[model samples]
Target: MEFPDDLKYSREHEWVLVEGKVATVGISAFAESQLGDVVFVELPGTGDSVTKDEAMGVVESVKAVSDVYSPISGTVLEVNDDLPDNTELVNDDPYGDGWMVKIEMSDPSELEDLMDAEEYQAFIAEAES
Candidate 1:
């Protein structure tokens, strides 16, 4: 499992990539692996307000249906329209094209609550044990 150092991770297994005030959100590779094959994705509409640590969307896999949480408070700027039509991308490129949404942050401070790649690696390691 490779946790890219450029991203921040939530304990719920969501990853965040922030540029300016916009954040791109997605499930980490580890989360996708645990979910098995992704069959469906339900994303919040553009302009929807999302609270930190709350369920903003869902990913359904062959194993289970899981909530995809928002790591920061924000208004959704965009959703990956390709997901509903091509769910396999979530498994094939979790860090790239598999990204779910872009959020215009309401509070950048909320990022402080998330873990960096190194910390997230340790977190999942502890979880697996």
Candidate 2:
């Protein structure tokens, strides 16, 4: 329900914050709520290459095990190392410390395909209907 206006979102529920060529990625607040209490996270290592739409990691919650997808193709520059041990951060602050990865993007143009906050709000509205 809390969608940040500055971030781009995927219909699959990932959020992206682009700063120059680097994109910090995370699941949206709505996504964390749907998944319930997160128990574990499996993330890609630094220096890993990820393709757009590809599975980059896994997040296991009390309700389900979900794949975290890359919103853009890039090389992993950083990952939230604390997430595997402290999963509650994903729920408590999805837009900040809950960020899953930071990647050096392969194509900035790919960002155009993702939805802005307003569009994503409409997207989820239609989805829940």
Top candidate on lDDT is 1
How many clashing pairs per prediction, in order?
0, 0
Q: Which residues of candidate 1, in runs, are more than 4 Å off?
A: none
Query: Candidate 2: worst 10 consecutive residues by lDDT?
Result: 54-63
Model 2 residue 65 CA deviation in Å: 0.8
Q: How accurate locally, in lDDT, is each candidate?
A: 0.96, 0.95
lDDT of 1 by residue, 17-72 (tens): 99999999999999999999999999999999999999999999987999999999
Off by over 4 Å in 2: none
Clash list (residue pairs), candidate 2 = none
The candidate 1 region of ten consecutive residues with least summed lDDT is: 54-63
Tens-digit per-residue lDDT, 1-129, candidate 2: 689889999988999999999999999999999999999999999999999999999999987999999999989999999888899999999999899999999999999999999999999999989
Q: Candidate 2 at residue 113, lDDT?
A: 93
TM-scores for every predicted model: 0.99, 0.98
Q: How many angstroms is residue 28 displaced in model 1 relative to the true structure, after the best TM-score fit?
A: 0.3
